[model samples]
Target chain A: MIKIDQLSKVFQTSNQSIQAVDHIDLQINKGEIFGMIGYSGAGKSTFIRLINRLEEPSAGSVLIDDQDITKLSKRDLRISRQEIGMIFQHFNLLWSRTVRENIAFPLEIAGLSKTERSERVDQLIQLVGLTGREDAYPAQLSGGQKQRVGIARALANNPKVLLCDEATSALDPETTDSILSLLVDINEKLGLTIILITHEMHVIQKICHNVAVMEDGRIVEQGSVLDVFSHPKQPVTKKFVEQVMGKPDNEVADDIFIQQVNSGKVLKLQFIGESTNQAFISQVAKKYDVELNILQGNIKQTQAGAYGSLYIQVTGTDEVVSQAIAYMDSTSIEVEVVAND
Target chain B: MTDLFPNVDWPDLMIATGETFYMTIVALIGALILGLLLGLLLYLTSPGGLWQNKYIHIITATFVNVFRAIPFAILIFLLFPVTIFLFGTFRGTTPAIPALIVGTAPFYGRLVEIALREIDKGVVEAAQAMGAKTSTIIFKVLLKESIPALVSGLTVTSIALVGYTAIAGMIGAGGLGDYAYFYGFTRRNFDIVFVCTVLIVIIVFIFQFIGDWMTKRLDKR
Candidate 1:
């Protein structure tokens, strides 16, 4: 578990000061995947670095498992840092060291003996799925393999919290998915609290249980991933939600069905969780004698459950359409009539 | 062979070669340790370094620059008092070592600093994020990462040190330079000077070969 309180960082230049991270407070639960999504210069990187004091905070405190990290002395901070593992976007591996030696580096810092380090490193290599390439240098491996070494090295000490600063930003899409899955696997197996900052919404949608949308160094919105996806409140949050959801209204409006519809209503249906699995459209059509025309729809899976939106044109007598709308509104599905001609 | 170089003394030339080896090897070891420490200090105290201190950086930079700028010939005469204070005399190979180290350590220090600076900043941050102590980062990360550059830099410094030892020999330290200057050049024994030049060239070649081999072997990147 991690609790950040009023964390701030201001970089002073020769003639001006840049506030990289403003006063921000956040709480991340244990064994949960918490994601911070923001564009570049949104202070997400600085925010993550402040958690480990890699970038010393200008103000505020970070509490990890109830221990105030900001107040610790230098010696104590090093000891505490062993319990907080961090991985970088560049996979900052020691090129001079082999995979085995790189993974054993943190164990060496933690004062583990040779045998203990070897045994732990072997297990970690297996956990991250980097088995046969133990003797290879970082340059000899692919981008994904390099990131695996970075993960194996970070997890060597069995830290309580894993901080990932754009951990997969440098990887291709396929590699990024693999690394994200590995992070999920690690979180599940170790019950480690994961705090990752990324600009990709897919990463949050794939593995994160909770999502926070940041703007101008402030967290403008935070909630369960499903809630944020289904009902995005802030403009930035909506933009990110649209990253996965597509531009819904524009796409549906461009459809020929919506353009040619004369009578009846073009309804936009929002489905969340269990509603996506039900036969609401069929049931409404069968009961009310209305022709159901599904123009376009997108269904996506989140950590919580399924979330989707559908655009459908209902054509029938006015009385029957009203009855069908009333019947659908009674169910869990949300019905919005976009056009009534 | 005897007719070709009647003035050349075989035994004395061998002894002179041995003396050159002794001075170069000892001075090199001394410079390696001292320069490494100085370079680490310069790097660690530099801006955005692990221990960023403008004052320590400026002072160390000044010291390195001052010693590095002084000509090696003048450096020997300038360090005459230090040589005498340390060795109780300034007229032999051992006394020549003090000046040799003092003159070359700063030059080697600048090279070491450059080698350290060539290391990726992200790697150092990775080590620090791993909870490594400053000592561990210096020894394990910074030193280990820059071995190739450090070795190559040392090769250049060692070659320069060989030349410095010859200059020292011209003063009072007994080596091939002394043999060449006293027994060959000054005494009109061109054969002795020519042979000494050949031996020094061989020594330089050996150093360069070893340095290149080690650098190639150690550098995985």
Candidate 2:
């Protein structure tokens, strides 16, 4: 486990000192996919960079597996740095070195022999699925392929922790999905604890088991991926969720429900885990003797369990409306009434 | 014109050609090593390279500019008493070599600094993130990565050295330029001048060719 405690970083420009990373306290568990989502200047990148001591923290401690890395000596720091592999936003591969040599760089620094470095490089090349491009330079590879090499190189030492600072932000969507999957594979196969930081919530929605939402150098909200996505608390967290699910137009949704259920009523329902099945929707409709209209419903299975939110318009007598509410209350689902248009 | 072109002294021509090669090679080795080290210090100590100490940067930069501002001809003539004191002889090829070293070191140092500064910061960051020590980042990263630019800088330095060697003829440095000035111009034999000029051209071409080959071979992108 990696524990980041009250870490802050201040960069001094010509005019004044600017705090890039505010006091942030976070814990990333072992073998977990953790995501830090924020805007460009929200300091997610700096937070990622701090873990590897690429940028030193101005105020707090970063304990990697209970050892405070901020106190390591220069020589010990180099050794500690090898344990925390980092993939960059621009895919900072050495242009002069071949893909194989680039991947073998850290191994060489670790004082591995030539034959051993080559063997490790070969294994990494195959792991990243770039078997034949070993002799090729970074310029010859596409954006996605270059990132794969970045991944292969970061994992050269089988690091216990991998810090990916906007690692997939430059790639296309299809490429992003594949790279995320490969990261998931690496996490599972090597048991490497991964911290993926990006502005895209879809990236978090896809792979992150736990997530922290950052804004203006501070983490405003953080929890399980499923909890945060399904029931986002903060405005920033909701905005991040909206980025993935599109803006849930409460006004438009109310208008559509009122137009459809003008004679009766409509209510928004949230179901998590066992209550998310079609049977629950049917059970309430059957008990109330009403026709159910699920205008918008989204379901996603997370590391925890299945979680989803649904918007429904039920048409029946007033007596049945209360019965439907009472029926939904029997299960672990939150039901709320939408106002008439 | 026929009388001026006669008595070309072929053996003297061979000896002068050998001397030119000796001076260029030796001076080039000394200047390149010193200049490269000085250039690296300039690069690292500048505003944002690795070490950004303004006081150190200003001091070294001022020192380089001071030596670099002096014209090679005047510099050779000016450093005469000191040169004679050190080497016990100011007129010979061995003593003239130090004059050339002093003349070209700072010139090439600035060139090397420019080449090193041109290296992309991304490449350096990549090496550092890979657990490379500072020494490794210098030798294995910056030097290896900046080879193409370094080669091009060296080409510029050697060509400039060729020009400086021509100026060295005034001090009787016994190179092709000296032969051209003494036997060709002073003795009024145009053939020696023409042959020496041709040989200098060929040498410049050789350096250019080698520089071009090195750039093409090392350029990764």
Q: What would you estimate as the lDDT of candidate 1?
A: 0.92
CA lDDT of each candidate?
0.92, 0.84
Q: Give a tens-digit lDDT track for model 2, residues A1-341.
A: 99889999999989999889999999989999999999999998888988888888899999999989989887888888888888987898878899998899889988999999999999999998998998999999999899999999899988889989899999999999899989989888988899989999888888888999999899989998878987799998998888777766465564544565555556777656533578887777666688788777776655556666677777777777778877786777877777442
**Steric clash pairs (candidate 1):** none
Q: Candidate 1, which segments miss by more than 4 Å at Cα?
A: A260-267, A274-294, A312-331, A336-341
Clashing pairs in 2: none
For each candidate, what TM-score against the reference? 0.92, 0.88
lDDT of 2 by residue, B66-129 (tens): 8899999999998898888999877657788888888888888898888887777866876777
Tens digit of per-residue lDDT, candidate 1, span B42-161: 999999888999999999999999998999999998988888888889998999998999999999999999999999999999998988999999999999999999999999999998
Q: Which runs of model 2 end up more than 4 angstroms from their true locations?
A: A255-341, B1-7, B48-55, B85-87
Interface RMSD of each: 0.6, 1.2
Candidate 2 chain B, run of 10 with poorest lDDT: B1-10
